[model samples]
Target: MKGSFSISVQNNTVKYAFSLKRNITIIQGDSATGKTTLVDLIREYEQNGTDSGISLSCEKKCRVLEGNDWNSHLSLLKNCIIFIDEGNRFVESKEFASEVKKSDNYFVIVTREGLENLPYSIEEIYGIHTSGKYSDLKQVYHEFYKIYGNFNLENKIQKLITEDSNSGFDFFNSVSQKKYICESAGCKSNIYKKLLESGSENVLAIVDGAAFGSQMNLVSELLEKRKNLSLFVPESFEWIILKSGVVKDVEKILEHPEDFADSTEFFSWEQFFTKLLTEKTKGTYLKYSKQKLNPNYLSDSIKNKILNLDLLAFLQNSVQ
Candidate 1:
């Protein structure tokens, strides 16, 4: 955990050789970069205890923490070389950063994005590269900052004003007007029933994509049977604004800064919303959304999906 070590592989397409001199090392690159493959080979070498080229200077056993299963190996995390691969969803988490900072273990994290609030120094990050001999492939200061870019970390402090839903009778006071909410979920009759409480009518109906597509039968039934009701998703509404040019850039409309701590150009929605709550809101600031999924994070193929959404017209019509 305190010294340098190297992984020297033979007859493999992964990292031919990589060395770590710090307590925390970050290996970041795009997908299919042979990141996980290297971790597997290292783990296999350690488990087999063969004369493989992996060299360890620490007393603790070497382990590869794969996926979300990294948490299961927590007990063995101390004073060892902890190699955590991407896709675990913990790479961008603050909790993981806090936990990692509290220990003396050495970490080799394979991720496409950088972690926030980590203890690692700037010299710790390296852009992993494949397709070279062990002599030519050893990683150096990759300056991931150039590849990913920088972001805004402006934290806003405000008074903690608390309010309760029961404290306001606004929704209840206007109850006789027949308030309605629409969501996307189809084919789940029980869900529809639950949403449509006795006096409330369709209290929880949804068009949730996660549920399934629209059921014409149920949609028509609800439409005919229920009056003074409406369903809308804020995201769909957002699409409307975008299609109409009411707000051209999603980042500007959402008021989420087109910045991220790591992928500077990728327009991080998480940091943006976090800014709104901690910076721009009144009352109790409720931060929403997570992950670094925005326009900048999309691949060219799937990037079109974000632009060619058919819901634009529907969103526009619903709003108007």
Candidate 2:
């Protein structure tokens, strides 16, 4: 269940080949992008098998979950890759998020709207596009592409905006050292509003990419019109700590997060990393807490180690 799964589903007119590495994968894009068609193929195959004029090949079962009875349907499934097309109000509900956290199955949801209740990764958000590889040019080929890319931090930052007021903000606020203004957006949803009101020429938003999928589209659209803003999205603050080599025996986990991140136990990678940090630093001077960061972590030796990471190298230039 921790391993990745690749799926190949096709009919005479179209084909989709993609891999799902995490528990939650979101498929969204413009119209006629084969998002719905991908779900239809799975539903069709589920109801009629090979005779449905479709072929599906995957190690795990692929099925569509919808309707008001989705809760009941989900209860009976395990170790599956469930697909949910848009218009299902259940997807946006807390009940669905609750079930998803408890279920061992993976999910591939198609929606343009973000689900704030679900802590899906920004890296998992994808858009479908035709790969343009087809036989006789009649059969279309669709593939999944990442909707968002890593932030470019080449520009100097005049202000820093973090998604939360907790440990993450504390760390960044300490590091800023009045070199630039560091403020919290309170939550991911408020990041857009913070950007709207900011008067800085260059702004950097540091958010937990692990659970920021819901606010990405809005922030992305805002970025297009506002060249002054850029994003510094790590999976989470805990991920930054783990990636900093501050924690021992985390190199493997950091390298292959998918292998250790259990879907049912932790809703997002952020939770997984948080638990890892708390456990690894238990009873140590660097003991971890989401509510308040340990003062020891802010010491020069430890602080420099974290800032030295490639992801946070921009802080050095900004502070200078």
Candidate 3:
């Protein structure tokens, strides 16, 4: 039910590469940026045409969906990688974004319009920048982070008032708050017990994509009782956005003299930014935390799909 596709295009003047995600991922840019050309190269490769500029590798067959055929195609499709050109008109509507996330397939969508439901910013799109690799599975761990795993469920769940099912969650709740899985911890009687006790409201459980490799079966057992109990994105969208958005600002701010001259205690860029993030957001910061608690399940080549997944936009749009 899972696979990967990677294509790199290189010519005398340009070189670009990006991979697709398990759910929806977008690529939007001005014309002649090689958006359609990239698709054409994939098609040519599919047709067995020789294009020295395009190199592709895949675990399974890849198909590009046409606008007229999307709905019917999805109905018939089950597990596969699909490329939907925006010209096929799939990314233009809120409805299409809704339906696509609920499917069990991977997608690479090209369009200029932003789908608020998807976790892509204009900067993170495929063709936006020509140089970087799409998925980097480097493990980011910190000595300060105490490992958390199989422990007292009862103790983790008892600490607070029940949260309403319809209560919405954004990046803020994750920063410095504990919603209490159990104050004393819930017994392993059922993972969903706290969720059920809390009520039918939208309780979002977000984990790292790497967890899929190590403990997905355990996670799945919990889900069998209730599908809405948890969530897992490639990493955190907070990390993704920081890397994509604020880092630029940090670099720009660095251009002027004495931004950090006053602070002798902050030596590393990571330390400076961690301090800055805490200051800016009132300690609603993401730093020094490890990427995931579990071991990886996928090979180095295909893991990027999970690493780069935008679970934030996907869940916000998919959950009711």
Candidate 4:
């Protein structure tokens, strides 16, 4: 529920080894990539144990969730790692998201369709990769690889785009300071459209990486086609503020947020960061508000502190 879990599952034919840390992990790839095969192995191991010729190893219980009675099946699980194969239509529903928000379990979902209702991390999206056979040559080796790599800006940015309509947008818009255009896409789902419509030669789109999983595939495809586009995805604006050293005694928490962020309490790391920032800054000059950024955050010292952080330091020359 809070820590990472590594899983090793295999039969005589193939082996899969991977680790999942967040509440939601997405596995998606073209056909014949062993996406379904991995799930099948898990199901087989669960149904027949070692007798099924399949071996599954993990610290936590691993099982599959499916069928029309998924809500019931999910309700009984706790502190588990659940696997849901593709074709589980319930995974796309608001009902499933609601349940996931309340469940104390990690999910490894295989699907080509985006689950907008679920606030999963873009970093958690992965695809299967086959890398030859095992030592015995009896089992094929399979592993998970991140579908999207880190985004870095090699060229100067001429414009800024945000997925937020309020505080985040306000902060970046203020940073642009009329030198460059900064616009908000209004929401995460609209970021791609704004990018498609943005004809600028150099643009940087800022978004909440913690909840941007649903848009990664499509947006990444567009990124491949457009050389001038760049993405700057942090956990959230609140996370940026906390990481700025504006908050005291937060180094440990920032280093490993998973230790503090619980699955049931927070649907995504962004939500946890929002709550953490709001609570830590309450009744102080640095008080946080998502509806509108506190003007104090725009001050030279605070602004410089934020921009000085390594993750955002690149924006210093652009904003100036």
- Candidate 4: where are CA atoms >4 Å away? 134-155
Best model number under lDDT: 2
RMSD of model 3 against the true structure:
18.8
Error of 3 at 251 (Å): 29
lDDT score for residue 156 of model 1: 15
Which digits, one per residue and each the tens of the lDDT, describe model 2 over residues 91-176?
99998999998889999999989898998887788777576632111111111012122334565568999997999999999999
Error of 3 at 217 (Å): 38
What is the Cα-based lDDT of residue 191 in candidate 1? 36
Off by over 4 Å in 2: 133-155
Worst 10 residues of 4 by lDDT: 135-144
Decide which is better by lDDT, 2 or 4. 2
CA RMSD of each candidate after superposition: 16.9, 4.1, 18.8, 4.1
Record all residue pairs in model 4 with backbone atoms less than 3 Å apart, i.e. clashing.
none
TM-score-based ranking: 2, 4, 1, 3
| C-alpha local distance difference test of each model | 0.41, 0.84, 0.41, 0.83
TM-score of each: 0.38, 0.91, 0.38, 0.91
Residue-level error in angstroms, candidate 3, position 64: 1.1
Query: What's each prediction's clash count?
Result: 13, 0, 21, 0
